[model samples]
Target: MKKKTTIYDIAAKLGLTAATVSRALNNNTKISFNTRKLVLETALEMNYEQNKLALALKSGKSYNVGVIVPRIDSNFFSSVIRGIEEELYPKGYHVIICQTHNQENIENEKINSLVNVQVDGILMSISNANLEANKGLNKLLKNKKTPLVFFDRKKDIKGISSVTIDDFKGGYDATKHLLDQGCKRIAHLSNDRNFEIFRNRYLGYRQALLDNGIEFDESLVIETQSNVQDGRRAARLLLDMEAPPDAIFSSSDFAALGAIQEIKESGFNIPEDMCVVGFSNEPFTRFMELTTISTVDQFPLDMGRKAAQVFLEEVGHTEDVKTTQNIVLTPELIVRRSSSKK
Candidate 1:
């Protein structure tokens, strides 16, 4: 393999001291714009790659942000990431993204790794709510070297800022809408047992039924992995019951779409034999004409940008107040052919 380029090599070629080269590379205010430009050009010509770890050790400002999400392919998380980038990029921050695949161990490991790397801050949506270690998490908050922010999928931890939607309200509204459509018997497709968000959703569903004078049937509630196949399987089991559900509320669009496929295959009609409502409002949800109530619109981007902004503020580049803010955006319920009884 070719030798990796270093700042010393660039300094040598440009006839400048290593310290000058480093400061120029870091955009120090003392360096004139022209000198900085020259150093940057020479560094690029020599294929120089700055040692980020060493620089972080010296400056205390990494200019690097870490973002963790349950999964990246989903529309909700990705949008939040995009929002994060939009807010941070202009301020000369770079983001490192890690996906946990909904595993607590993996998520913990990733957070540790980011901490070790000396990232200025972290904006994370946890993989599994059950994986939160208060000791470990509190250490991060108290470190004073790095700040942490949570968005979506956040644990109910005090002193940590989080940006999330009212998941309970979303769930209640989705269920209430189906109930309003005269869905006498309703079922819910829930996610894993470890996720608090899904648990809250299930709670909302039960509460809506109780408020509407509908009996809460434990038999109608199904829990599965947050994926299409699990959704399809859950739908099959529900459909096979002696008395099938009149409506189904899924916490995930992926599962809702999967259930829809299975329902159609089982010779059931949409909105007639069974009404389907999904969450997340993913792109496919609209294309497939599935009724959905999704929270956190392009929220990944907003989450990412806001997280980055927090880091910047923490480091004193900006006077953004360090408030333990809990921002909850309302979710919109989109009605479509799937849920309309008319």
Candidate 2:
């Protein structure tokens, strides 16, 4: 086995003290520019590597952050990740992403694992699973104080910063748009209310209906997962009702796509017979062609950048508990062919 080159070996080769080599490698201003350049060139020639663990111990920073999400397959999450990377890459920090698969236990495990590895911070979007007795929150800083920030799906914990869209407004705008298009009977496909984001969306939907003199019907609302199959099933169930809905306001783009597919398969013309609006302005929402569903744009890329900014701000404070900051971005209701009455 070949032995690894160290600063001590580089120092010996240069006939200089180990401290001088270390200072030059760290780019300390005290070291002269010529000496620093010479040390760097010689170290590269010798294949020298700095011990990251020792540096982390000395500086109290891993220069690595953990980013947890429900899933990366979705366009929204992937775009958000791209934004985070764009902001943090130049800062000499890289992210380690973890997917919770909408499971609370899995989310907790990921937090513990990240903490064990001594990550500098953690950014997450909580899972769909109910967190009545969540252990992940407790396990976050048992060993070390890690900066934590929430993006999109988040909780209202004191001293914890979060960046999210105005979900209530998104829901209200989507529902109100369908109403403006002369949709009398509107059905809502919602998700679990255990999450604040979903609950706010549902509330917005109901508020729009109530404000427009339409009675909010519980039967017209169905709680389903944010997936294509679930959306299709919910659409079918609504269609089978005694008085079928003329429009649908879904909280997920995938679900809205499923409902559109089901509506078309049942020989219905979109906007003519049934109008539809979905959340998350996903990539497919624009190029849906036949469906081209109307959706609320949450600006996920900006959300990720804002979340990274919050993490940076939180990490800057030297105290164990940092001050909280809540940044709520606006949601844009995009008008598309799927919901246009013309």
Candidate 3:
């Protein structure tokens, strides 16, 4: 391999001080634009790789932000990650992403690892296990004061900020939409009840039924794992009941898709026999023509952007953490063929 070029080599070639080259590489505002451009060109020509770790150590500013997500395979969270990258990359920030696989131990370990890396800040969407009453992640994050921001799956930790959608309202709107379509005996296909967003959704569903003078039927509610298989199983169980639900409001689009599959397999016509509404307006929802009421465009992208903005503001001291902010964006309900009944 060719000898790797260093900043000193670039500085020597340009007859400028190494400090000027360093400042230019970092896009330091103090350096003149022309000089910065010239130094950057020289560094590139010499194949000089910028040493981020050395720069971080010298300034005590990593220019790196860590994000912990449950999983990246989901459309919702992935979009949020994209949003975060869009907001931070332009401002000279790098993101390190880690997944917890929804395990408490894994989540704890990831957070600790990020903290050890001296990251400037962390943005997290904790797992279901972390939300359990026995989990100690809330205490751990709070005690560290590590400039943590929670999005989507957040717990109420003092001094930490969060950006999320109004999950309760999303639940209410989904249930209400089904009811408006003449669904009296409707059931919910729920995810892990420990997650605050899911719990809030359940509450909203119950409240909407109560407001509409519909009896809250415990037998009609089916709890399932956060996936399509569980949704399919729950649909089968509900369909086998003596008085099957006329409609279903699922907390996840994956679950709703499963429910639709099972319903169709059972020879029940959709909308005419059973209507389905799903959350998280995922791309597949529109493609498949499923009627769903969803919250947040995708928590990952929006949350990521908002979380980075928060870190930027906090670092600049333009925004104070003393006044903790909980920003909840509104959800939209998309009417489609699946839930419509003439």
Candidate 4:
């Protein structure tokens, strides 16, 4: 096996002390610039890799952060991650990403694992399955004094910071847009009510209907997963009704697409016969050029940036002083062809 180079090897090669090599490698301002440059060049020549664990032990910080999301493939989550990385990378922090697949057990395991590895902080979007109070996760973080920031999907736990868009307003805006387009009977494709984001969105939908003097019918609402198949099934159910809905306000873009597909297959003219609105403003929404489906822009990138900032602030404080911040970004409703019946 090949031997790995170390700071000691660099020091020996450069005829310098190990302490000087270490300080130079860490970019300590105490070390002279010329000496630091020489040590760096020597370290590079010897292929020396600084031991992160040793530095973490000395500095009391791993300089590594863990990020947990339901799924990395989703555009919203991916963009949020990108924004987080963009903000933290320049601040000398490394991010480790974990996906939970929307399972609570997996989310718990990931949290425990990241804490065990001595990460400085954790940023997460709690899974749909984590509907209950995350007492266990909270206890673990509190014990470790690790800063935790929740983005998008969040649990209502004290001493934890969270960054999210106003989902209730997003839902309200989407539904109101449909109502303004003269959609008297609007069906809603909702997700599990256990999640606050989905629940708030449903509330917004109901409120909009009431405000517009339209009766809210339970039959017009369908609980569905945010996927094309579920959206298709939900749309079919609505279409099969004795009096089908004239519009749909979906909680997710993928479901809205599915609904659109089902509506077209049923020979319904969009906006004329059935209007639709989806959330998240996914890229494909515009490409498909389906009737401009009104959508809520959650500004996932900004969500990520703010979540990272919260983590930084929490970690910056002393362990004895814990500060929590709840940041809610405003959601913007983008009017598009899908819901423009006028």
Candidate 5:
């Protein structure tokens, strides 16, 4: 007796992805005609059957989903999970939360474990660790035929659905607000440029400066991880510069708060002598007793819910019908005492 042929076997023989072979067999227009013809010829040569692996074919569904995040402690990530739970609970789905703590190894382990357990789907916010060479995450998921959705911090790969806010607009709005306050020299505190969200925010900041006739100074842009200590250290460095900025826009709310503390300790008044802005709209940003920080709200809860919705839409559909969708929500700027000089 001979074993049945599978798309994985075909993919391995052709040095291509199983997904590409499946798409070609389904006559997906996205694949080039030459590639499709080659795939069809190979399928006929190998006597391959047309039982394409579909999400609906999976039996004994555990009705469980795994959500991987960098850390669960952040208000943003936690709130997004809360939203995911709220949307999934009514559908008789259980969510297993996994934290990577920004480590790629832990992330890979969690994803592998989830796939082995045959979870129906996975939702994740990718880590910033450079794992492009590995290419294990997407391959594992696709090979397992499990659906994937990304919320918040996501990879920009094709074929994966994602829900996120317009980070560029968020950054632009944050900087524009500070410029509107009549601050001429502004500094930006940013994080790793490898992450699209952080990079977009920084780009937005520079674009805002350029739009307002302010020169883009790389010296004024300090790479801060957006924590309190990082913010304080960054503020100290900016103040020591020959020409210090009177305004600062940070990619992290916690970093912005740290900068505020450092500014005050150094004899600068908020929104008077030095204005500050931050991202993430962390709850503390709006609840300060003396000074509240102004920041951009990424709508993490809504992002989570939308991501769950994307999963629901894709689940139980054939691979031929599972089209990738990208959803971007709008971010709102909440002005407060920190940067609102006017």
Candidate 6:
């Protein structure tokens, strides 16, 4: 195996002390510009690499941040990760991503693993399951004094900061749009009600109905996963009702796609017979051209960037003086062909 070159090797090659080489590498103002330049050149020529772990141990900073998401394949999470990387990479920080698949146990384990590795900070979106029950995981992160930032999905933890959008307003906009399109009975395809995001969306839907003087029908609401199959099943159940809904406000684009497929199969002309709207504005929503599904533009990339900025700010402060922040980005409603009647 080839031997890895170190700062000591570079120092010997340049006839300088290892401390001098290190200071040069770190861009210490104490080192002369000419000496720093020469040390850098020698280090490059000798293929010398600085030990990050050793440096972290000395400075009490790993320069590594952990990001936890429910799933990476989704467009929202992927875009958020990209935004985070764009912001943190320039600041000499490495991001470690972990997916929990919306499982609380997996989320707990990932938090523990990241904490055990002594990561400088953690950014996460809580899963659909109740996070308050996972007190142990929260305690572990708190004990380690690691900065925690939640993006999109969050919990009401005292010390943690969060970056999210107004989901209630998003839901209200979607439902109100459907009502304007002459949708008298609107069905809702919901996810787990345990999380505040989904619950707020459901509340928005209900409030929109009430504000419009439309009687809220409990039968029109169906619980579903954020997938096509569950969406199809939910739609079928709604269709089987004696008075089926004239529109559907789904919490997921994937579910909306499934509902669209089932609706078409049942001989319903979209926008004429039934209108639909979905959340998140997933990529597939545009490709299908199913309906002008009014969706919430969560500004995932911005969310990620803001989350990284929060981490940077918190990490710079002393543990005792750290302050929590809750940044809420405005969600824009993108009206499309699926939900537009006029």
TM-score versus the correct structure, for each prediction? 0.78, 0.85, 0.85, 0.85, 0.81, 0.86
Weakest 10 consecutive residues of candidate 5 by summed lDDT: 51-60
Global fold similarity of model 2 (TM-score)? 0.85
Ranking by lDDT: 2, 4, 5, 6, 3, 1
- Clash list (residue pairs), candidate 4: 291-337, 291-338, 292-336, 292-337, 292-338, 293-338
lDDT of 4 by residue, 72-164 (tens): 988899999999999998566899999989877787889889988888888989885354455547666559677788899988877778999
Estimate, for each residue in 1-342, the C-alpha lDDT of model 5 and write its tens digit.
998888888888888899999889766789999998888888878888765234226445677899999898789999999999999875557899999888777888888899888788999898854647425485665584888898877777779899998999999999999889999899999999888899999999999999999999999999988589999999999999898999999999999999999999999899899999899989999999889999999999999899999998998577888889899999999999988877
Model 2 global lDDT (CA atoms, 0 to 1): 0.89
Q: What's every prediction's RMSD, in angstroms?
A: 5.2, 4.3, 3.5, 4.1, 13.5, 3.8
> What are the Cα lDDT values of the candidates?
0.78, 0.89, 0.81, 0.88, 0.87, 0.87
lDDT of 1 by residue, 13-58 (tens): 8888988988898878799999999988887787877776676677
Clash count in backbone of candidate 1: 14
Off by over 4 Å in 4: 1-51, 128-144, 289-292
Angstrom error of the Cα, residue 104, model 3: value is 1.1
On a 0 to 100 scale, what is the lDDT of residue 257 in model 4? 89
Rank ordering of all candidates by TM-score, starting from the highest: 6, 2, 4, 3, 5, 1
Per-residue lDDT of 265 in model 4: 95
Backbone atom clashes (below 3 Å) for every candidate = 14, 0, 5, 6, 0, 6
Query: Candidate 2 has which clashing residue pairs, if any?
Result: none
Winner by TM-score between candidate 6 and candidate 4: 6
